[model samples]
Target: MSRNIEIEFKNIVTEEEFQLLLRTFHISKKQFFSQKNHYFDTKDFALKKLGSALRIREKQEQYELTLKKPADIGLLEINDVINQTEANMLMNHSVFPSGEVKDELHKMKFPIDEFFLYGTLQTDRAETEYKNGLLVFDHSFYLGKEDFELEYETIDRDKGEQFFNELLEKLNIKIRYADNKISRLFKVIQGKKES
Candidate 1:
């Protein structure tokens, strides 16, 4: 298991803007990779209510379970690597594995047993280094809906925010409120249930 703090800035962008950023950065199709995030939450969104989330990310034939919780600066992510068998058990049988993430959930007083596979969001993403930060471009699909996003991950918050905003302004891309992937997917799920 591993733990880290994630400090990132994000912005929603239109398809045009997404493509523009790709061209501007000289990112080619070969640079993009696909990953699926299997989100887990209670029916009532207990995790979301606490501003926390859990997911098992499938990338490059490997799976990683991560729990994201609010921290002082960004989010604290507790990650555990799971084998294919463990991944299958979780996705196919709703079995929550035991590990550091499980331990962290217990510490948070979260009902870990109540979490089930809520949904999955898949993204075709490409990332490059920009101004001493990692800049990410994502085209994600979930619950029959799709969106484009730009993300800048950095250790320094103030400088990262400034650089991200400056880049958006320089590209003439109007900033839009962008929720993280899980939240965006959850919103659609809730909307569907309401309608």
Candidate 2:
């Protein structure tokens, strides 16, 4: 199984300072994780919506199934299948829900356009923290819920492809393309005001 590694930080710097930070990291604003493939982009209002979602505490495990068209983004997902007890139990074993069992129960269809940027950290257990009004998840953290707060942007397919390639190079992270599905934890927020 492939591991994901990432960290979320509050954007406290000015635009120029932020640019400088990107240079230091050898990345760009576009290289930051966002719902780039969705119909929304990271705008002020969208960020508010996402922030609201981030404030909730509905925990569960997540599962994702990616596609090919959007080179960097996943095309489909099956998220939040495990509870806390189950997660703890399955940590050391390769446990997957049976397809026949899922097929027996009619579940909601996976949202197609939704996309997320996820990276793991080096730890045995993942961690989640609410820092400076942002919900930050450490690499090993997985809550079995889907509280994705994001906006989408529209880009020409060619441009989007190029952007993904550049991002891979800038981050120095190997890019993997797959139609396989995976699991993680989820946390959903109800109606909440922005901080």
Candidate 3:
């Protein structure tokens, strides 16, 4: 198991803006990779209510389960590597694997057994180092909806925000509301249910 603090600034961007950034940054198509996030939550969204999220990320034939909780600075991400069998069990049977992630859920009083696969979000992503931060470009598709996003991840909050904002200004992109991927997916799912 591993733990880390994630501090990042994000902005939802238009397709035109996304393309512009790619060209400006000299990011080739070959730099992009695909990853899938399989989100999980209870029927009542207990984890979401607590401002936490859980997902098993699939990339390069490997799986990692991560639980994100609010932290003083950013979000505390607890991750555990799991094999294909373990990943399948959790997704197919709602079985919580024995690890730090499950233990954390227990501490939060979440009914882990009730957790089920919420949905999946797939992203074609590329990353580069920019101004002492990790800059990310994502074109994601989920639930029949597609969007582009720019993310800057850094340990320094103030500097990261400055760089992120300046990049947006340079690109002529307005700052817009950009929810995290899980939250975006949940909103679409909830909207579908309501409709």
lDDT of each: 0.93, 0.26, 0.95
| TM-score between candidate 3 and the true structure | 0.98
Report the C-alpha lDDT of model 1 over 1-195, residue by residue, as the tens digit: 999999999999999999999999999999999999999988898988889889999999999999999999999999999988988888778777889998888888877667789899999999999999999999999999999999999999999999999999999999998998999998898899899
* Candidate achieving the largest TM-score: 3
Per-residue CA lDDT of model 3 for 67-178, tens digit only, reads 9999999899999999999999999999888999999998888878899999999999999999988999999999999999999999999989998999899889999989
Model 2 alpha-carbon drift over 4 Å, by segment: 1-21, 24-74, 92-157, 165-195
State the local distance difference test value for candidate 3. 0.95
The reply for model 1, stretches above 4 Å from the true place, is: none
**TM-scores for every candidate against the unseen true structure:** 0.97, 0.24, 0.98
Candidate 2 Cα lDDT to native: 0.26
Q: Backbone clashes in each candidate structure, one number apiece?
A: 0, 28, 0
**Local error of candidate 1 at residue 38 (angstroms):** 0.4
Cα error of candidate 3 at position 94, Å: 0.5
